[model samples]
Target: MSQPRAGHAPVRPRAPVIRRAAGSRAVALGVCASEPSHEAGAAAVARRLALPLLTSGTDPRHCTRLDALLCLDGDDLSLRQTGRRAPGPVRVDFGAAAMRHRRAGGHNELLGRAVGVGKKTPLVVLDATAGLGRDACVLADLGCRVTLCEREPVIAELLQAGLTAAARRGDPWLDALLSRMRFYPGDARSPRVHSDPAADVIYLDPMFEPRDKYAAVKKDMALLQRLLENSPVQSDAGQLLDWALQQPVARVVVKRPIRALSLGERTPSHSIAGRAVRYDVHVLRSLN
Candidate 1:
C-alpha cells in the first residue's frame, strides 16, 4: 500500500505454474456441483490456477493418474490427492497452540525467546514464509501484531479461506486474535516487503528438503512438501536469508530442523533448540 522506497520497484505477482509428479496425469480444479455454494469459489480457483474443472459425476476415485485435485468443499479450498484417502485440509488452528502457550505462560517458549518477544514492548512480526500460518497464529496469540506473507497463490488462498472460516466461528477470543493478524500476498524477498516499517522481527521458515521419510512425516506436511518440491525459491535458503538480513527489522528468526544445516553462510547471533526444531536468531539491533 505504501510507495516503494527509493530504488525499490514494486514486485508483481507471477503467474501460477502447476507442477505435478513425474508420470502423473494433469490435475483439475473442480467443485462438488451438488454443493452449489462452492461453485463460484471453484470457478475462481480454476481460473487462478489455470486448470480445467472436473465434470460433475466423474468419480474422484477414478482419477488415479491425476496429480491432485483442487476442490472447493463448502468454504474450504483444499488440494487433495486423487484416489487416496484425503489428507486433511491444511487449516490454521490457534486454539490448541494458544492453549499450550498459555499453559506454559505465553511467549516463554523457545520460539518466543528466539523472536525477542519479551524485549522493550509488544513486537510486530512479519511471518515472511507463512506456510499454513501455524507459527503466525502462535505469535498473535502471544500478543504480537503479526502480518503473514505467503507468495504461493494456492497456499495463500487456503490460508485466507481458513482464516475467514475461523473468524466466522464467532468465538470471542479467536475473533480478537484474528483481528491482530493481517495478510499480504507477495514474496517475502520482494523489495516491497522490506520497505515496510511495521515489522520489528522477520521470521523465515523456508521449506527444506526432508531428511526423514518414515513415520515422522505428517500427512499435511507431506502434501505441502510435494506441492513445493518444484519451486525454485523454496529450495534456495541462502537467497531468502540474504533478503531477511537486508530488512530493517530488529531481528530475524529462521526455523530449521534440529539437526539440519544452517540456512546460509552467516552464523546466527544465537539459537534456541527444541526437541524437533531449532530457531536461528539473527540480531540486527538489540531489542532491549
Candidate 2:
C-alpha cells in the first residue's frame, strides 16, 4: 500500500502522557506481499490510537510513523483520513479497527421531540461546549449539521483522531454521519457562527459547576476536565447566550442535568424533561 495524501495529527492517548524515547524501536510492514501504502497506514494507526507500534512485530529504527498498515489478509491496523483538508500524503487510515467511543444515551431524555432536525433541513448546530463529540455525533446522526467548537487542542486532537479513525475504516454509517459534523477548533463562548451557520436550532452542552463535594466524576470525565482546565470556568455563559441569541438560529437548546438552573437571567421559552437532565429550548425567530 502507498501513503495517503492528507494531514491529520496523531491523537495523543489520555494516559502515558510521555512520548517514548526517540527511536525506541523499529516498525515495518512486510513488503514481499505488502504494498508501500500499507506501511504508511499501519504507522498512522499507531499514532492515532497512541498504541505501541507493531505490538505483534519488531519495532524499526528508521520509520516515519506507519501512516498505515497493509493487510496481508484481514489482520492489520487500517488508517483513516481526518477530513477534507490536507496538503500532502494523507496518512493511511491506521486506527481503523479501534472504534471504542460511542454516544451517551442519557441525552435522549433531553431530546424529546425537539424540532429542527430532518432530511435536507438546513440546521446549523453550535455545540458551544463540545466537551467531546458524543452529543454532536448524535445530532449528526439525526441529520443536523453540527459544528463542534472545542477550545482545547488536546481534546480537539482526540476528536479529530476518533473521527479520522472512524472515517478510515470505511465505516459507512459513521463516515456518512461525521461528514456533517463540523469541528470548529476554538472557544465557542462567542463562536464565529458562519454566515449561514446559525440554524433553526442550536445546541449547548456546557459543563456545569458540580453541586456536591462528595460527587466523584468519572475517570474519563475527570481526565477531560483536566485537559480543559480553562474551559467554562472562565467561560461567560451569559455572554455566550447573548452571542448565540444574535445568531440566525431559531431555537437554542441547552442540555443541563436535572439539578442545574437555567442559564443566565434569560428565561427559557420552554423546558423538556428527560430522565436525568433537562433540555431548555430558548426559542428565537432569527439572529441574522
Candidate 3:
C-alpha cells in the first residue's frame, strides 16, 4: 500500500475495544492441502501469506493448534475452522444456486439502482471493499464493468481462485459476466486506483463491528471477522469514505446498516433504503 500524501495522513478511525473470553488465544491461521495434487498450490499460497503449510496427509480439522486453515482441495479453495464445533468452510462461488437464483429473478435491483446501472452505456464501477466480490459479481451481471479491490492477501487469494474456477467452467453466460470483472489485490485508496479515470461510480462497503452483539452473522462474515481481529491492516473507515468522496467520479455509494449513522457523519445527497441495509449516494454530478 502507498503511503498517504507526504504531509497528510489518513485520519484513523477509533479502534474498537475488543474483549476476549477467558483462556481464548489469538487466531492461528495456516494453509493445508487435502489431496496430493493440491499440495503445490497450497504450498504456494502458504508462502504468499507467510502461513504454515500442513502436508496433504494431515487432516486440517484435527490440527487443534491452528484456528483456521486455507485449504486447496481439488479445484476449489475454502477457509475452514479447526474445532469440531466450528462452522462450515467459506468460499466464493458465483455459480452457487443462490446467486444463480438471484441473477435469474432480477432481485439485485437495489444495488443496481444505487449505482445508476441503467445508463446509456455500461458504467465502470470500482468496488473499494470487495470482501468476497459478491456485489462486484452482481454489478457485472447487471452490465457494469466492475473492478474488485481487496487488500487482505488470504481473502484476495480465495476471491481470485473463485473467479478462475468460474472461468474454467466453460459456460457462455457465466463467461460474459466474468469478462466484465477484474481483480486488484491491493488498497483501493492507492494512487494507482485513482489513475483509472474511467470509473463513473465508486462503491464502498466499509465493514465495522456489528451493532447488535447477539445478532447472528453469516458463516463467511463470521470467519472474516475472526480474520480481521488478527489482521494488521486497520485502515480507517472514515478515511476510505473521505478518499472516495474526493475521487473524480459521477457519484459515490456507501453501503451501511440501516440503523447506523452516515459514514463520516456527512449527509448524502440521497439514499436508497432496504429492509436491513441502506445505500447512501453522494452525487457529484449527473450521470448524463
The candidate maximizing TM-score is 3
Error of 3 at 139 (Å): 0.4
lDDT of 3 by residue, 92-173 (tens): 8888887777775433898899999887377999999998888888889899988889987788888887887788788897
- Pairs of residues clashing in candidate 3: none
lDDT of 2 by residue, 33-127 (tens): 13443434444544543543343332222233432222211233222211233112112122322222223354542462453454236566777
Name every residue pair that clashes in candidate 1: none
Predictions in order: lDDT: 0.68, 0.51, 0.77
Each model's total of backbone clashes: 0, 36, 0
Off by over 4 Å in 1: 1-34, 56-59, 93-108, 194-197, 210-216, 232-234
TM-score each candidate.
0.80, 0.60, 0.87
Q: How close is candidate 2 to the true structure, as a TM-score?
A: 0.60
Error of 2 at 212 (Å): 5.1
Model 3 spans > 4 angstroms off: 1-25, 104-107, 210-216
On lDDT, the candidate that comes out on top is 3
Q: In candidate 2, which residue ranges exceed 4 Å CA deviation?
A: 1-106, 118-120, 189-198, 211-216, 230-233, 286-288
Model 1 is weakest, by summed lDDT over 10 consecutive residues, at 1-10
